[model samples]
Target: MASEESLEESKKKVYRKEQALKRTAESLEDDEEIELPRKRYYRQRAHSNPFSDHELIYPAKPEDMKWSMLYGGSNEAPTVADVGCGFGGLLVSLSPALPKERILGIEIRVQVTQYVLDRIHALRKQNQGKEVDYTNIACLRGNAMKFLPNFFGKGQLKKVFFCFPDPHFKLRKHKARIISPTLLSEYAYCLRPGGIVYTITDVKDLHDWMRSHLEAHPLFERLSSEEEESDECVKIMTTATEEGKKVARNGGSKYIACFRRTENPK
Candidate 1:
């Protein structure tokens, strides 16, 4: 027969085990309430073609893009695109600046894209009766480098912004940079003649790389400092992006380069 102290110890062990099991069951039940599927957090490799990933968010073609869903019967396609629009500060600022123009923000991360979507929805609801409505702005999860032409027809856009894009610091990963000679041709295809492509970054090397590539590209012409300063959008591009604001807080220098899509060679 066990002593009274031993019996008490056994009872305490059983009680603690029971409590632990109960807590686990309750935790599982709580998890069941979250029905949304988990999104994949990483891509194994950069997509060479946009259409290869059937599950990635995208319209089949420019006509099927459904712009009216965002702008409510506005037939005009989005004239501005904020590529790699992390946290969507630039898009929000531009929405009010160009109330009549439709703008799209392209982000690859699912959670970040969803956050921007929610932010835009909230802004629209909040400003329903206000003079400045936010229905002109929208966010899409996409690989802009691959699928840009899929969403916009040839020469559909007037302005394309690459605000503080990923530097891809490694020499081997440089192709992943948003600005490249090959990508510039695609950008030129989507931008109307004389359309502006605005690029800003705190990384001086990346800035020089982008400027050099755009300068060498046959379809792009570098914008003069006077021309860059004259445009209202340039000011917003510098101060309105989340990355830009962060750089400002850290006292980092910002480099800006703008290019115009020249008309096709005669």
Candidate 2:
């Protein structure tokens, strides 16, 4: 038999989900306005196996993607990517920060992606006709590590972010980590020379692992501490992620490592 506490928690979960469905409906149909999605209602497990197969939508190639559909009639392709953009905290923060550049957040989870999509829709509706209408940021459901090249042309992106990614602490799981040699080469293909990759995490081990991999990759060069402090995207990512804020509240350490994609060798 379940305890009263357990029953109460289950009831709350059902109620919260219903509320989410109602809010989603309002955001879809209403012209005037709608409230932002509460993250609690969109909860999911923190870790997803990047290796798993899931039904996902992606373009065969960069040019085949219908950018205008996501950007609301704008033909401009996204120049920034928030890989593994959990709940889209960075995407919302980066939207107005870089208003002219389109930003895309890719997440693997279904419910979490829906929350971000609805959140962006609500924000866009709220700011309709305003000077900064959030037409610059969008969220999509896909595996960033696998399909980045499928969605972005070579040298098309100027920046990519990996914020507090799954640490994958086990030795066997290192391949699942987002910043590996092969993936870095793929990232280099998508980013123009001099483009940046920003990474922040509360886990020291994962941070070091990512740093080492990027340093070893010929196509990447780590930014100096001075250079890191001066970069606006670096600043945004430090506090713009929900995980970053959680780490701060608990007085945990944050490790940030940024790298520049070098120009192709002759």
- In candidate 2 the C-alpha lDDT for residue 149 amounts to 95
Q: Model 1 TM-score?
A: 0.79
Per-residue lDDT of model 1, residues 93-165, tens digit only:
9998998888999887665676576567656655766888788889888898888888999998989999988
Give the whole-model CA lDDT for all candidates, comma-separated: 0.80, 0.89
Model 2 TM-score, 2 decimals: 0.90
RMSD of each: 11.5, 2.7
lDDT per residue, candidate 2, 1-266, as tens digits? 47986876686578567656756677567674567777766778898988898878898999999989889786789999999998888999998899889999999998799889878977887898898788899989999889999999999999999999999989999999999989999999999999999999999999999999999999999999999999988999999888889999999999999999998999
Clash list (residue pairs), candidate 1: none
Runs of candidate 1 exceeding 4 Å displacement:
1-54
TM-score each candidate: 0.79, 0.90
| Colliding pairs, model 2 | none
Q: CA shift at 217, candidate 2, in angstroms?
A: 0.7
